[model samples]
Target: VTYSRSPASPPDGPAHWRPWRFRMSNDVWGTPVVAGDLLYVTSFEVHALDVATGRRQFKTKDVAWTMAVDGGLIHGSDGPTVYALDAAGGHERWRVQADAWVYSLKARRGTVVTGTRGGGVQGWEASNGEKLWEITGAQTDFETPESGPVIHGDTVYIWKDARLRALEARTGMERWSYPVGDAASCGGVPVRVCAAPDGHVYVVAGTRVLAVDIDAGMVRWHFEAPAVFLSAPAFAPGPAVTGGGVYLADYLGTVYALDATTGKDRWRIATESRQSIEPVLVTGGNVHVGSGSAVYTLDAVTGTPMWRFAAGGEVMGSPVVADGRVHFGSADHVLYTLDAAGGQLRWKLATGGEITGSPVARGGVVYACSKDRCVYALDAVKGTATGRAR
Candidate 1:
């Protein structure tokens, strides 16, 4: 669920769910949310499914373009407003009008925050939608496309066109603004930043990956690739997800691992790619990634190729590693599950349409959403279909 995950109620579970599988409506974007016993999937509607049984618990109208759960509440955005809903009942707790179209929602530490298309960034009370504070006194470009704010701890990092700014989580005070660009100017290309465990940031800017120190408020080091600089919003690099240190790929199909604290180059390797190195998911001693038609698993500690599996179609979504298996969708309208340790094919299931979003799991159940206008919940082991959308 790379679109976003609830920062508070973190989802943790097995490698794959194969015994009991199920299906629901799908979409071109969005990820499923697994909180406790309920799995929330968003397509044309927001549905809450029983994690163990794959039963539809509740459904609501289009609520969250992006969603997160915190402090026992579900926070999401509908067009230009933010709504707090009961996670169990799918009922609205409160709604607040934003300054512009609210496209992203993040809730953590008892607060709900959002970023708008107009570059307006603000937060509110998670319980009743009381306005908190907004970050001010910086460049507010109406033309620059905006994105969501992600919280690591007490800081919220937001990226616009070229600048990545961090603000105090509670007071909305500006902490630092780093201008990320190449040799010439800054503020044009779409950028993404991921917080590292060492309180540093791995930023993806156009054709380079940079390591920025949160405390010092500057870049520790940056690795540039021999690729064309991408501007605006067409084929931007994926979000840099870090594990032991930093794992990111550029548009040129080069994946680099840099030391999280020292910014030392651990290893750099080329991938079998035609377009972009979308992103990497690191967990359970393995790194799951895709480029073009093949998915590769590399040793996170030594950067060794464990195995490579070429799918029947183009691997579109990022691979989610759970329950000792790698579950991902392909452009051929099929979801493939591979043995995480050996790269053997366990099973492949056909969906109604192209699988757009990544698969997510919790409690031995995996959830996938596709353009087939449905979401599927499959058993981690048997891959059986347990539920279907009505």
Candidate 2:
């Protein structure tokens, strides 16, 4: 099919027509992280897509379960063997077998780190994938680690046995640990940590967000709400030092902007539904997030609803904002484009399956993945198409 470029919200027919380049039919667990010309997308398999063509430059499915990218290597864990592939190509540089499957990956200060279901955090060389260091904090502790570790400047953070621990990123040496609430295992899920531009760290556990000074490793402030957190917390654009507040969404779909310095609530808006995906972009004094079957733009400061765009299917993936446009995928098997300022429908492209992975947008192209076993690169301009359909 072919047609002239038209407005995103076509008064009559489709806005633009195109095809998908690759099909990857599986659940996408992580967001598509973009570096430069390459977009790292993971499913049961991890593939590198060219930013301009949406063509598969390489595919690494050795682990096929959990894959994470940091520095220049993509690490995958499938029970015993952890394969680290060169980010540019699918070439395997090194393989290591841990006590169990490595479930998550984190990067900091030229170091690539991962946590295993066996309750061990391992660091590897970012260039050669060699074992740099390994630290077994606790033996599974009756529950496997779930949340991915966060890397601060010189420290790495993890949740082991319901308590937060800070480790040396370069050597995996124990520096300090904080027992947050109780000792009982909250199913061994790692606490989500957000690093402020300042020297403080914010950790989310269940229903509370705690702030800890980097130097002191002590709680400076904390804010608690009725809602429970399941995703990582994100910070808005600001200087890190003044202890800026963090933005978080709960299981109850209530979004709160909290003061970073005091851990006090600045504003709260209830969405009346659960938001599984983390809020993506905070631009122009508004926040963009996918909630149920709609995408919302809220006042960054006041938490007021600015606009909303309805999708044909439920929105599971986070929105990708670039060049004044909001792009996201829906369970309805469509890629939606909307006006960032007015929330007007720009265009909709139909895929063969649900889109669970969040998209990455750069330059004039958008890269996205779907359960239909496909990766698509779309032209940023209206009435244009790129790639081929299956």
Candidate 3:
């Protein structure tokens, strides 16, 4: 039956939708960082909660678009400024004032490097937030810089003006630059650049997928999609290289497995709808995707369908797997878990608002955040719903 006038309220859904244990009264847009005992999230304030009790450990009033942690240091950004906080107590250690919002945060070998929309990339001392080096004029032609900097070894790789530039991670000096697209394509803004254990850089930019030799900064092989790509391409897990090949999908919902060395197509599978820019994950011999309102599992080797799990709303974030189960959030204020092999619903927990961000599992517990202003800790084993041990 269709809703006549918005109905009395949302359907009750399953009783299992009730949350386990929760920390209340703040919206979370980015994924929660759980380290040792602290769960960190940023909305209008930075919150640190004890994982065992879900109790607030500390709070900082300044907020940011995202936050990250490396060991004891918490890194966060608020537009033109980035803050370094004491992870244990939310104490401000130091802060950096930059030209634009710090979009990418990476900690490498005692240095913190951040990418910004203001056409600048800056490196700072992770211990004290001191500016080590700054590179300017990394301008994008049209699209805002979406992908963050990917560092492999001592080199930093970033995209700007449709080209991929490899720079010295320590000094911000340019080593070499490879045009991902022609000058006509506005220097193909890459969706993501990932590195493999073998030292090759895998890139997905517009309709093309490229494997670059990081040392020489040269394209090893490139594969172009059969369809004209969206200026903003569909999202997939991306450039997942393992064994002998790489896996990625186009905006057209076609997933392709390419020979990692030669860029030859190994297999391709087309899904039901346009796969939006959500991240794709390949693990446990399966390729997991949250496409529109459905999540699908495909065989990693042949691209054959394994199973599909339907959700009540659009799933924008990628799913996480642990202990033979799949966990993800939906637009309809729900967190769901399923048996990885059979696509069977294990449990789903309801939330105060849309569950747009992804879920993280650690230490046998799954943690999720919602736009409605809450963070929930759920039991990963049975979903019988109890938070902490208290």
Candidate 4:
């Protein structure tokens, strides 16, 4: 029952199958978000498609980056305007313009929030995109904002000029701000943090990695390492409650696991070469990640090298572990599938262009988009490609 735009050749399937096609523009700059039978994507235009029919349900051409969606609305930003659209019909709701480019968008309750270049932060109505309030004026100048804003209940968190600000999600009022380091000294927007399942915010700043308590907004622990900076803290769900250890990768091609509670080093692995993708920890003590042209599996607990698999090109997006497989896209214009535990090659499907967006797996389908401007939904367990040409 899977539909696709690529001429379906039943390489290994039933006889009475029909090949399908979903028409799209020649470029998909953002990722695809699948909901039910409808798949949503943004490029120069926003589109909603019937995944099983390869038919366009709705299309909106005004906005560019459809960043995040939740609470039944498609939230996005183009330049400085953050807008929301009716999730079902692609109908325009309302739009709000920020002082700088809004690159990150999120939604919670009735509000939509976005982070902007030059340290601008804003909150809006998720239903109408009305500007509820905003906060600006950080100490140092910021560059293009790319880091996401994380919301923990009513608290919205973002880094502006090297300071991570916790704001009242409703009023855009600052609750507390923590300075990671000198913003100007480390370039702009240096710290990237994620909310651990244990409720602590883990961030990387200069040579120090920090864990901050969510409610009190105080630094609970900090770890120092001489690792090259690039990757952010990654946490896995486990029984360790004092602080769930965080995993990170550095530009120097090393991965480290740090105990969240004591800021102590657990283990580190040097990936023989450089790695740009974030390390992914999967179920059953498996960690899957990629570097340059190589993918690897390591013991999630012991950091012991398990196996390594090489791809055709560089890996940019983080590897997605799902349904017993590790999925990732490469600059070589191919989407690779690997056994999550053994790092063995499953399959690699070639694309017409480079893939930067993360692969999304839902149901039994693996969905991915490439700069060549196409979105594909492949059979996750079968490697049967089903998708459209731009």
Candidate 1 regions exceeding 4 Å error are: 1-29, 136-146, 160-162, 181-188, 228-243, 274-278, 385-390
lDDT of 3 by residue, 308-383 (tens): 9889988857799988999999988889999999999988987778885679887667888887677777667655
**Model 2 segments more than 4 A misplaced:** 1-20, 24-29, 137-146, 182-190, 239-244, 275-280, 383-386
Alpha-carbon deviation at 81 in model 1, angstroms: 1.5
Q: lDDT per prediction?
A: 0.67, 0.69, 0.71, 0.70
List the RMSD of every prediction in angstroms: 6.9, 4.8, 7.5, 4.0
Rank candidates, TM-score, best first: 4, 3, 2, 1
Please report how far candidate 3 places residue 210 from its true position, in Å: 0.8
Alpha carbon lDDT of residue 158, candidate 4?
Answer: 68
Q: lDDT score, residue 146, model 3?
A: 41
Top-scoring candidate (lDDT): 3
lDDT per residue (tens digit) for residues 273-298 in model 2: 75564643566677777777888888
Off by over 4 Å in 3: 1-20, 139-146, 182-191, 228-244, 386-390
TM-score of each: 0.82, 0.85, 0.86, 0.87
lDDT of 2: 0.69
Candidate 3 CA-lDDT value: 0.71
What TM-score does candidate 4 reach? 0.87
Clash number for each model = 31, 15, 9, 3
